[model samples]
Target: MLLLLLFLSLPPLSAAQLCHPNDLAALLAFKNSFSNPNSSLPSWDPQFHCCNWYGVECNDTTNRVLGLDIASVDLHGTIPPSLSKLHHLQRLRLHKLPNLVGPIPPELGQLPLLGYLVISWTNISGPIPSFLTNLRSLSYLILSFNRLSGPIPPSLPSLPYLYAIDLSRNLLTGPIPESFGHFLLSTALDLSHNMLSGDIPASLGNVNFSRIKLSRNKLSGDASVLFGKDKVADTIDISRNSFEFDFSKVGFMESLDVLDISHNKIYGSIPKQITEAVYLQFLNVSYNRMCGEIPTGWKLKYRSESWDNSSFFHNRCLCGVPLDPCK
Candidate 1:
């Protein structure tokens, strides 16, 4: 009788929670923010469990919204600031939504756990908000192929964990902030196809990038800082700019596979050290002011696959087998 009484005194176990009601309400508001989301979100039935809804993921134990991935859908809406309600949201991706317009909502700063945030290939406009620095956990921030304008925030260096940043194909102007050089080591930096003008910051030489592209901008000055025998950059493209640097003195890293300094005001002969870069695959030195016989080496010695006359054309005077013999 004592054993049975002890068992009867035990408290009843409660079932684990469902998606937080507030989180569910936030998602519903996000759906309503769109003018035409019914067809795209057919599975977002109010009666069903939000964890089972399309493009929404919830934690297995707490049943709280954890991730939201909605790509290539025909939803026409600004990112609803209400999304901040998902206190545990970690990944938020909204890609290839061509009709989606407006600026990134500032309320995203409240999501302290947000790490991966992508809003690419859409029509989001306006300056990238400074509030994004509040995302202390941000790892990858890609906002390419949009119409964002204005100078890049100088405070971006404050994000302690931000690694890869892609703000390419936007309308951004002004010199790249010197703080950009403080980005974590080997960060992939792409600020291409923008109207950014002024000197390429000298500070950039301090960082070792995995790949760096500043092409099709109005940038100028000594790009030589990016090159050194000790540097480990894998690829560098500063093409279609007014950059004037002495290519003859610049050294290449063995890791270099692609280098495009074409259509610039750069002078000096192609350095002989380029021969040491066996990983070279794509090269375009055309339309520059460089002169002298082209350097000969593993990849440069061959006149096929972009080592030919066309690659060395339109220069003041370049000789050797690719052109006519130096006389």
Candidate 2:
């Protein structure tokens, strides 16, 4: 009788109660928000348990919603604010829906555990929401290949755990925030192919970034601060900008591998210090105002076969090993 009494006190384990009622309603509401979800999410039917819905993951012990990953779906409509109902949502991705539009909902700031938030390859527009700073657990922020415009939120770096950020290939305009120099934990940053202008915060010179790409923008001023013998940055691509710096003064970190600073107003002989970058596999200094003989690193000749004729061309004054002999 004691065992039967214990069994009778346990919650029902019916298929309909597989997930928290709040999570189930939130999922159904999210499906309803989309105008054409049936073709992509047929498994999200009300007759079945919400945990069995495609792209939804639930915790085994609590049966609470944990992840909602929906990509390449024919979803058409704004992201429903009702998604905030998933109090335990940790990963939220809505990628490759070219038709999904509108600004990121403010309600998302309510998700305290959200770590990976990606809504790329869509028509999502408007400024990046500053409220995103509230996600104390966020680590990855990928909003690339969209129509997002306006200034990047400076508060992004304040997120203590943010590890990577990619806001490339957008229509953003304005100068990168000076507060960006305060980041101490972020390792990778890509703000390329936007309309950002003005000086790169010299404060960034102190932060040790592993990879930083600021190519194809209107950014000007000396970018030499990003280079230093003490820094360990492995990749630095700031090509095709109006940057005017004396390349000779720049220092190459031993960890340098990819360096592209072409198509700028940079004037000076190619720095011999670059030869010290033993791990460098990609180098492009072409289409600048640089002059004098290119440094044939005793190490460069080993990789000379990979250096194309155009790699050192258009500088008009660069000469030697790969080109006609210096005059």
Best by the TM-score measure: 2
Per-residue CA lDDT of model 1 for 1-327, tens digit only, reads 999999999875332225587888889888988998688788887777888888898888888888999888898878888999888999999889998899888999999999999899999899999999999999889999988999999988778888788999999999999998787647888999999999999999988888899999999999898888888888899999999988899989988888999999999998888888877888889899988988765654333365677777888887886788889
Best by lDDT: 2
TM-score of each: 0.91, 0.93
Off by over 4 Å in 2: 1-12, 298-305
lDDT of 1: 0.87
Minimum summed lDDT over a 10-residue window in model 2 is located at 297-306
Q: Please state the error at residue 61 of candidate 2 in Å.
A: 2.2
Query: What is candidate 2's lDDT per residue for 182-294, written digit by digit as tens?
Result: 78684688999999999888888867888899999999998998889989898999999999988988888988888999998889998888888888888889899988888
| Model 2: per-residue Cα lDDT at residue 41 | 84
